[model samples]
Target: MNFTLHQLQVFLKVSETKSITKAAEELFLTQPAVSIQLKNFQDQFDIPLTEVVGRQLYVTDFGQEIAFAAQAIIDQVNAINYKLAAYKGQLSGRLKIASVSTGKYVIPFFLSGFLRGNPQIELKLDVTNKAQVVRSLVDNEIDFALVSILPDKVPVHAVPLMENRLVLVAGRDFQPPLGVSGIEIFQYITLIYRESGSGTRLAMEGFLNDHKVPIKKMLVLTSNEAVKQAVMAGLGCSIMPVIGIKNELKQGDLKVIEVKGLPICTYWNLIYLKSKRLSPVAEAFLSYLDREKNTVIEQNFQ
Candidate 1:
């Protein structure tokens, strides 16, 4: 099978994302183009590269081996690019990073500064749920993941980047009684929550379990933006990151409703699989984040 490097890259990306649509978006190509190329690549081999199960795409066992080989090739090419750029005294390579929905509020600033400083380095950012971010970590799909709750089973090195606090907030019409127990707070108001796989939801659940609050009525939304909108519309109160609600707070669209042991405080962790090997660009970005994240967060978030 005579496959070009582009084809290998397409295959690897599709495998990593498990979605041709997402792979196309990442590759800056149309869905049909990606599908055509993948079909051609698959046609040359005897084994099926992938299969769809329950409307979800999955790589076959043979495809897994092919993906590993393709990654090795890609890594070597990146290494060569890194070495050549270093020879010219510059950093250049692609960086893939995934972050939880809440981190989406602030991670762009971090990337913007880095991009201005390293114009040659490319970035692909995916703002998704905690579950997808964790899967990305496990599959080595990204160089870094910004999340508050790291999966316990994933062997990852997590570095604290910024403060993340989930607070109970309500619109002007919905008055919440503050200075109450965590248990009482839920009883008094209809709680809006992010999806189950979200870090915000997980944190809220942990707090509820700790306080022995019963699982009660909730309005679950799929995104932080959705929850924010729902809160602003006075549909219900929600627990969300302070970073996400800065504008709402300043614009007087929402107000913080305090509860005892509330606003579950957690640190935003920049994590990657412990066994994953980072490219020069990834390493440089990590160093840059380590050195500048706190300052950037302080300036942008506050």
Candidate 2:
């Protein structure tokens, strides 16, 4: 209750960047100054906000909870300023949005079109994996989130934006077994998988679990591009979003497996805190998403 906005801002930046040094550089402050500010803020509460693991600083669970509240406070304050400025006939403000890695392929296209019509608005986009996206949303660091999988317990409102079908893709040179049904294709090749905490990974795991596919020898990677490259190199096969492999498919660099009862299509949702009041810029962006959701999905997917 007694924290200053500057302290909250510093905390948010550090949490987002995961480094006090990097956060200080971004905020144009010295590292020691940033550390002092963070220490001062942490002293107000009984529990420590950050924990050091080896050389890295990580936000503790308690810290994360406080950070979430801090973000809401910051957002509300900005919303008030935006409202006052809007009454004075200024419709200019920055909107920050975080999205899952796959969303990078789709959100920018929609954002470009939206920006064309509203030149006064500025956008700050953070492209990361699903876990980071959820964390940012929960912390109020992002105004909205676009992700493939929704968390079980979210303090936010989420709306289904589009349904994505996962596809099994392989290099052009890799040959799938002949005279086999789609469900049987899994027996022919080693599976390449995404790292833990990935939405795509979670969806694929759920699908395999439902189908009872044994996955003891699958190779795991941290990036979609890396998975694609590995597939192209004939390292292994992977299940990926069709959107991520559109160009590869078009170029014949990869081929989608024709599998029946596979892929387990999932919905990508747009998420925002349920109780937080949105600023005009954030509200306009949300409206744009609602209006153009179908069009964007069709244009990108089909």
Candidate 3:
């Protein structure tokens, strides 16, 4: 079987995106042209690479194996080009990354510094919840992830950046129960929660479970911004990462509820796959993060 470099590149993009249309858009090719290339690749190998499941496309195990090999080849080719370009003293490339919601607020500061220093580097950022961030990292869909929760069996190298303190917040209109403990405060007020599989939600649940707080009436919402909006609207109170609500708290739009034995703190980590090689741009960004980690956190959270 014979395939061109363009075919390999297209296949890798499609595998990463899991959507033909999206891949086509990214590659600047029409849907039919992308489909024809994929069909030719499949026919040459006499194997099905992707299957449509519901409205989404999924790469088969065999397809993933091929895609992985293709990605390695592509990375090597790009590395060669980068080295060649380095001989002329130029650093330029695209960097793709994923991050949890809270990191959306802090990571940009470091990235901005890096971008200012290297204007030639293009950065693509995908900000989602913790679960999606982890998923994207594991699937090799993203180069690195900035997240608050570290999975038990992470197949990646993670560097703890800072502790993400979860604070119980409420609208300024709401009052904390007087002389009551953290556990008791839950009994007096309705709780607004982050959606399932969210790191914030998991941390809050673990804390509640540890304290033996029964959760009966709870409102689940997605995204930290949404949670802050709900709390500001006086819908209910929530426990979220301090970085997410720092502005609200400072502006008096929201207030931090002081509860005994509360403020669940977890570490935020800069995670990347152990086996995958980092591109020069990615390495430079990581170095910038390592250097400015403390300063960024202090300025953002304090």
Candidate 4:
């Protein structure tokens, strides 16, 4: 059976996303185009590569094996391209990074200079929840994982990027009930929190448990931005990183409340497994960080 490289790429994407529409969006192609290519690719095989049921797509067991081979071919093609770029005295390769959702605000600053300098480099930055980020890091699918709270039982090296300061924030016009301070404020107000798997939620839980703040009424949101919006809408107050809410604070949409022992601090760390090997692109990025991170920190976070 013969298939074009584009077919393999399309099949790989479809396998990853499990949705023709999403694969089309990522590939910048029309839905009909993706569907046509996918059908063309599947025609090469006798057995079904994919199955549709109740508006859901599922890859057949045989399709998973084909996808594995397809990924290998794609990697080989990428390696050849990188080698050719090197022959031309140009740095070019794919650099994949996974960052927790809240880390979206921080990763770009560290990457902007390096990415701008290496114009040929392809950067895949996946902004996702902490659990997915950690899973990708553990599976060796990503070159780096940006997070504030490190995963347990994972032996990884962490390079501290910046301090993550989490503060208690409410709408600008929000006022705590009289005599509410410290743990008492939590009792008086509905507390907002990120989902359970989030690094921010883990940190917030640790702080609250350590301080023995009994959260009575709680509202859970899926992301930091959601929690911020909820707080701004006067739904509840939340513990949020200053990095994410800086603009709202400046715009007077939100205000931080001074609670004793509040403003929990942790360092945002760029982490990688100790046993994992770094690619040339990854090595170059690490060197660049070592050389210029101080200036980046001072200019951005400081």
Candidate 5:
């Protein structure tokens, strides 16, 4: 069977997006054109590459193998292009970075300069929960995983960029009930928490457990922004990282509730698999992070 690299590229793009229309748009081709190429590629094979079920594209078992092989070829070709650019001391290639959702506050500041400096590099960022970010790291899907809490089971290298300070916060109208004990405070107010997979949630629970304070009658929100909004509406008090609340705190839309043993501190890390080799772009990014992390955090967080 003979097929062009273009066919494989289209197939991989389709696999990635799970939508032919999206793949066509990404490849700058019309939907009909993409469909024609897909048909031609299928004509060369007996097994089905993909199927549609319930309005969603699902790759067949054989299609997965084909996609994997296609990805390998694409990666090798990209590696060649990166090496060619490297000979000229330029950076060009795909850089996929995964981070926990809360990283939105910090990663952009850390990346702005590096991204501006390496304009040729194509950047893809995945912002999700901590579990997903760590899974991406372990699966070798991302070049860097920016996370606050590292997975204990995963053997990886973690570079600490800055401190993640978790502080108790409430709506402007609420007063800090820093009286009696931590347990007593929990008894008086409803606690708001980030969803289960969140790094912030994990840190909060760990801190509470260490102090033997039990959480009950709590509200859980999927994202930090949502939680902030909920707290600003005076739904409940929450433990949130200072990095995410700077603007709110400054504007007095939200205020920190000084609890007796609060402001749990943790490190934000730029993590990657220890066994996976870094590409030139990834290596350059690591160096750039090392050189600029302190200054960037100081300028943004300090």
Candidate 6:
């Protein structure tokens, strides 16, 4: 039996979303059109690739296997197209990068110039916590990882992009007591913290331990935005990257609390494993960074 690449693509999307309607929306096709293509693709295979039960679609175990193979085939085809474009002197390829959640403020500025210069490049950026970002890098799921704290466990090369400063901040209404200094100030207010394995959490903890600060109350949140909102709501003060809180600080919604040895500083690093081979697109990005990082940082971040 013969099946076309378009059919394979439809089936793969169907398997991923487990709903013809959703697959069609993502693929920019009508539901009936996608359903008909899926049916045609299934007809060629003796074994069922998908099944429906309880009014919901599910990819069978075999269907999952086929979806994996389909993904590889699609990737290869895209690579061939990119290579062909390169032969015509146009740089084109997919560049995948995984970054910690707070890195949102940093990575995009660095990417803007490169992406503009290479109009044909497809960029896949995954903004997650440090643990997941590191996992993606170690598993070879991405070409690069953006982080502020280096993963000591991984053997990798790091390119320091810019300074990342974390400051302890409270809502606009917070007022310090008559005479409190250094770590003693922590006793006056609750602390908002990120979840375990977050780079921000790690750095906050390191600072607390180094100063032997005693926390009276603590609240754990899963994301930077959530923590920022919680702090803005006056739930508690949190140590957060200055870059992430620029708007809040400018609007007078948040205020940085001055204490001795505050504003923990770290370098935002673009890292990749030492053993992984760099793609042409990745190499080009490195060269671009070398040439433009300083200008980009000065223009946008300063």
Q: Please give, for residues 114-147, the per-residue lDDT of candidate 4 as tens digits.
A: 9999887889999999999999999999999999
CA lDDT of every candidate: 0.87, 0.85, 0.84, 0.93, 0.88, 0.93
Better of 1 and 5 by lDDT: 5
- Which regions of candidate 6 fall more than 4 Å away from where they truly are? 1-58, 177-181
Candidate 3 residues 60-130, lDDT tens each?
99999999999999888877776766777877777888988778876787677778887667677988888
Which numbered prediction scores highest in TM-score against the true structure? 4
lDDT of 4: 0.93
In Å, residue 243's CA in model 2 sits off its true spot by: 0.8
Model 2 pairs whose backbones collide: none
lDDT of 6 by residue, 78-98 (tens): 989998989999999999999
Error of 3 at 244 (Å): 1.3
lDDT of 1 by residue, 1-302 (tens): 69988999999999999999999988999999999889989998999999999999999999999999999998898779877887899888889999998888867888888889987787878899999988887888789999998788788898887788888898977755666654576886778888879999999888888888765578889999999999899888887889888888999999988778787999888888889899888888888887898788778876
RMSD of 4: 1.9
lDDT of 3: 0.84
lDDT of 4 at 133: 97
Give the higher-lDDT candidate: 2 or 4. Answer: 4
